[model samples]
Target: MARYAEVVRWPLVEALAAYEHRLREHARRQYELDFIAWCILAQSGATKRKRPPALPTILKEE
Candidate 1:
């Protein structure tokens, strides 16, 4: 849990610092996992794999 502080903090701090130091157009997001999404991911860490992948590889049968 403590290890994930960077994952949650980096993007927000990065964005805020970018805006503070640079223009909005120049400030690109470094990560997709913002604070809210990170919270969700942390809460639901164990995602259930009830169904097979939507695009499973096809195989030739003998």
Candidate 2:
């Protein structure tokens, strides 16, 4: 079975880079995408986090 962290990490790395690139091209409002992408990265990494922003609610809820 695939390790869960390894599986999750690949997409996170890709998304963060993509979001950062897109953020530079987008208008100011689009900063939200970059912010949310980072929240996911910081949250999922389970690193030493000091008061990370709350993720925007419910882009896709199960």
Candidate 3:
């Protein structure tokens, strides 16, 4: 995962973090895996935000 982290552009960190937060909030049991699934859903245009936004990315660390 560290290798993948290196490839993440700094600007997109917020989008990723936002997805993780949503996962934690709504799918607390398996937030990690759910976050990935949410990304897939959003990317496939199955979610409200066809393209995730960065505003929600300003999440406080847990």
Candidate 4:
């Protein structure tokens, strides 16, 4: 369990740092929001499917 704790702790710290940076940059709040969602998903052991697209994907269907 020690290994797991170390791994989890570092990422949590990093996420907080990133969140602070985003707040300074005055970017949209969505990124910080998404980070919180991602943490919840990780804790729930919900397997994520394929990675998200590198760029935003917009659908223009009629």
In lDDT terms, which candidate is top?
Answer: 3
Instruction: Kindly list the per-residue Cα lDDT of model 4 for residues 1-62, writing each as its tens digit.
Output: 99767657777778787666655544334545666676677777767922322321221111
TM-score per candidate? 0.22, 0.29, 0.30, 0.34
Top candidate (TM-score): 4
Clash pairs of candidate 3? Answer: none
Q: Give the per-residue lDDT of model 3 (tens digit) for 1-62.
A: 98568546556778677767776576444545556777988777785645443322323345
TM-score quality measure for candidate 3: 0.30
User: In order, what lDDT does every prediction score?
Assistant: 0.44, 0.58, 0.59, 0.54
Give the residue spans of candidate 4 off by over 4 A: 1-28, 49-62
Runs in model 2 deviating more than 4 A are: 1-26, 46-62
| Cα lDDT, model 4, residue 17 | 77
RMSD of 4: 16.1
lDDT of 1 by residue, 1-62 (tens): 98666546777878676555544222223122243455565577735443323321221110
The per-candidate count of clashes, in order, stands at 0, 0, 0, 0
Candidate RMSDs in Å, in order, are 17.6, 15.7, 13.7, 16.1
> Where does candidate 4 clash, by residue pair?
none
* lDDT value, residue 37 of candidate 3: 70
Better of 2 and 4 by lDDT: 2
